[model samples]
Target: MANYIHVPDEAPAVPKIDVTVDERDYRSGALKLIKELRPSWKPSEVKVKFFTDGITNKLLGCYVGAVMQDVVLVRIYGNKTELLVDRENEVKSFRVLHAHRCAPRLYCTFNNGLCYEFLQGTALEPEHIRSQPVFRLIARQLAKYHAIHAHNGWVPQSDLWLKMGKYFALIPKYLKDPEQNTRLSTEVPSPQCLREELVWLQQSLSVLGSPVVLCHNDLLCKNIIYNQGAGNVKFIDYEYAGYNYQAYDIGNHFNEFAGLNEVDYSHYPDRAFQLQWLSSYLEAYKEHKGQGSEVTDGEVEVLYVQVNRFALASHFFWGLWALIQAKFSTIDFDFLG
Candidate 1:
């Protein structure tokens, strides 16, 4: 037998990318974007606070106390802005969950390849996440979100998913540990299994006959907020918002809950609590759509698989990205390790 083995490619060295903007430039660009968006607004009157060390993008706090009681949190990157306004566009798709949509949100791309979004409300910590009843509320909201929008044609047409797969393919080799990759890979069903499941899901989806609605793909705990006055949970960061599998939104939310550390999970106390939360969500969702008496156990099983696949895919995708960053000295081995 010819001795032939598949050897993974060596990690390629990445070149250094220059970062041109300093704190002053970031502040100036942010203020300018805000002023341009609202020409009548005075820069001196509004308080702009800077937030550094953001993992994804830079943030500049824009508080307008005179005009509105709420804050207009201006997210600033090198040359771009994400404006999150309050009490504007009513989220038309899901009626069960209360959400305020904003408009003319300035999204800008920076020279350093960063995107920014300006959102209102304070940053949420792990402790804050566990302290509130937002988990149940979010579950219900997502159920409603998924149920109302079935499949009317909108799906992610962006190249992001394809890029995501390319990134995932690099993780095992970049990590230099085939064993770890294998172990992580097994936690979710194989690609073959997913393809089969998707086939069935598509058939069922067509039979269900529902309109596809926009879904907020990134609904991590940080993206959700508790509005005390309105007594509802609001979702932020619509960057990843698009039409997707209804079950995907729910599964992603469940995964977000699962990703919480042990300290956070302790607050919920038992698997039953989680089940109850999921149940409440399903109930609300069914009520909003005016269909189905109960969420079947079979459906939950399918959702579980969907969630796992998404989680594994995410881990693999980010791992490769970290490797790319490491090659360029943008990230270090210690960070990847």
Candidate 2:
């Protein structure tokens, strides 16, 4: 087995593009964000470009003033995300994670928007997650993330089951309008089946007695920024970060390893792979949190089973999240798939 090693390098100078925001009404928010971020720069000197990958927010990449200048990510919450997300609590989570460097830095925030220091590097792909070295590095980062507690305020979902129940309850509202979502209406499991499964899952998982820790509920690869230059990964998008079962967090990430948009389950890690990966994560998590004991083989085996079962919760969480987004969000992504 290869040992995961760190070789840190100075983060390269953040590239700066110099261009002007087009004078249009739709451009107002982006322009406003730039002026708020760097009041010294004029609109004509700032370049406002839309980032195309977001599913839950309007992402804008803004370059203010000149090249070599720092970049900031401007996020406008999607149309109805506020109904499901408490921005105030989300902001507090960001502060705690950023303060310790587990997540990105928050430059500024407003009623419905935020300006974040742009993290350099590509988001990890499924292939990258499959790489042993990259996989181990991410495990360490996630372990570090799980150990974080919201120091400035209350963390959401100390009650994970109730939280998911709330999401499941939204199904009716989402399905009410005939046009709520043409595709998802046909794709999502019936409300009855979903509920029964939820109840059973909660009952079954209760036996594990998993620790309740802060989790990045949305562990999609896109939310993870890999900075090869720094020899580590940095988490972004704290909209769903909060307290939840430790097994659920690891399980959710493994589920995401299945990939997005055609979601091939074949890529999901096998038993042997899960054992190796989960063992590394558990050990690294303990080490980072200063637990001196080694994780036992029996414990790793139990966690492997636990995480695989918890993977079902991850599918349901995102499926419901997409249902809500399908009803209201205007972002371009295959929500039903």
Candidate 3:
């Protein structure tokens, strides 16, 4: 909790390799990239391991030694994800976080993916995050992450509304398969209804006065890695990271309490749990900002209101994202569900 590394004055450039690795036969392409990055390691000896936890991208771990101890993670971008995500901005966010010691070292970028260091830790499950110590570590780490000012001297602005607009525009009015189209009609609100809700969200949350800060935007349990022995946590994946309303970050995390594979809002944190979590976050946030580690009940109450309201936006945003994924992604996850 006492991490004191200063954010670098300038984020160093991540070297880029001009080759794209095909997800279907990633081994050959990954080995070729590894040969360039780690010249000493023989391509034949490199162990290529595929990771399945990710829903948006194909992840591969390449290493010669023990599993995660010394490995390079090769993340193949999802199909058409470039339309949903800002790849250039994603890299900028990655480098900024790495400079602040809040992220893993980005080894390099390839034509269609990124290669980076792998954290030797357990990816948290829904039950694990609700337990002790781990939750607090998450709270503090998020606070530290929020304290990062990557704008240099410019005013921070959230891309939430803009990205939401892009997702909405990209969503197909009708799926190519009529059954999928019919399913969309029954499963979700009409496009008009969604557009109206988006408008309502923009009007409602914009006035809440939540400070804009660098937010993870996606803080699902799977994205969190907890090193039990080290007693710390690290967040992975920056595809959705950017400056956003501080409350939106916390609210999105709160929404994630329901879990992904089997969403049950009943699992959402209770008032007592949220109060404690927010209190811890505020204390850590104050300490990071050079303010004394003290938080008032009123301060917590204000944030509570803002966060819960913003949580609605989180649900809406992902719902739209999933609709797009269902139509384009090859991943087996039921995005529309």
Candidate 4:
């Protein structure tokens, strides 16, 4: 039987005190929340911590001796848990309902907006991921996630084009201004080009007739962890997970393939890599649905264009946000640049 850490006799007590809305105090709150949440597990036992600390938010990872020693990831923020409880519950329900199709696990939301979960298996590094095989696996998994019958319960009412519009608005503010552009990038998109691309994306997304799915919009190599025994992959960090274009998930994974280091791409030419990846993914997706193709060749072509367009859109949206936070706060902007 796998070792399980029992809850301690007494939960660790965190002082009941609040501080001003500052980053230092936020860290303190996160530390305090961790103690309160895992009163049973010793802080020292947690290992292999990975997180990005900045103005956006904080995530902490540590190991607990559970089911072959699993990972406990905690995310902290200032918002009350009530605000997120519904979303978290929705996510949990989505996961549980799809347990046969994805990783099965337990999740808890602690005070101070800290959410933690015990996930099984080792996360895959960019170098270790077998591009063709894993790409196929991810595609099938996404199809399953999108197929769940959630009706109107959790789907975000806002349309995809509206979301793209918000992204379009930020490009100029980040790229045109001397200070902001210097802080973010040296080159700004020409006004004409930006306008044209925005129109193109709006039209493209409008005709995408596929139903929305629970998308892991951020499918960077780091988010996927390999499970050798199951011969499959699991995903984490569902913060960006929500109802969106099914094709968006495919595009995101394809983007990851394109962004690989020169060494990996050398092994597989870009076109060959995409073809193998898509073929495998589509095959698995077709098997799961046990029906005709859920996506078509024409749709895939549109997705390819959107992937590049979204890449540029994300560069500006996240870039400007980082630049503003860095200027307003003490955080570093190197990663943003």
lDDT of 4 by residue, 242-276 (tens): 55666666665554543433324343226555555
Compose the digit string of candidate 2's lDDT tens values, residues 1-337.
1111111233222222232333234376667666666788778877767776677777777785556347777777777788677676577667667666776767777556777888888888888887868888888888888766443434434456867787776754444446535545576677888889888988998777777777777888888888788888877898877777888988998888878876898888889888888777888888877896499999898888888888888887777777766666666675655
Which candidate achieves the best TM-score against the true structure? Answer: 3
Rank all candidate structures by their lDDT, best first, as comma-separated numbers. Answer: 3, 2, 4, 1
The TM-scores of all predictions, comma-separated, are: 0.58, 0.85, 0.96, 0.65
- Tell me the tens digit of each residue's lDDT in model 3 across 190-253: 8899999999999999999998888999999999999999999999999998889899999999
Question: What's the CA RMSD of model 4 in angstroms?
Answer: 8.6
lDDT of 1 by residue, 113-134 (tens): 3223443445454444434476
Better of 2 and 4 by TM-score: 2
Best by lDDT: 3
User: Scored by CA lDDT, what does every candidate get?
Assistant: 0.46, 0.73, 0.89, 0.51
Model 2: worst 10 consecutive residues (lDDT sum): 1-10
Return the candidate ranking by TM-score, descending: 3, 2, 4, 1
Which pairs, if any, clash in model 4?
Answer: 8-40
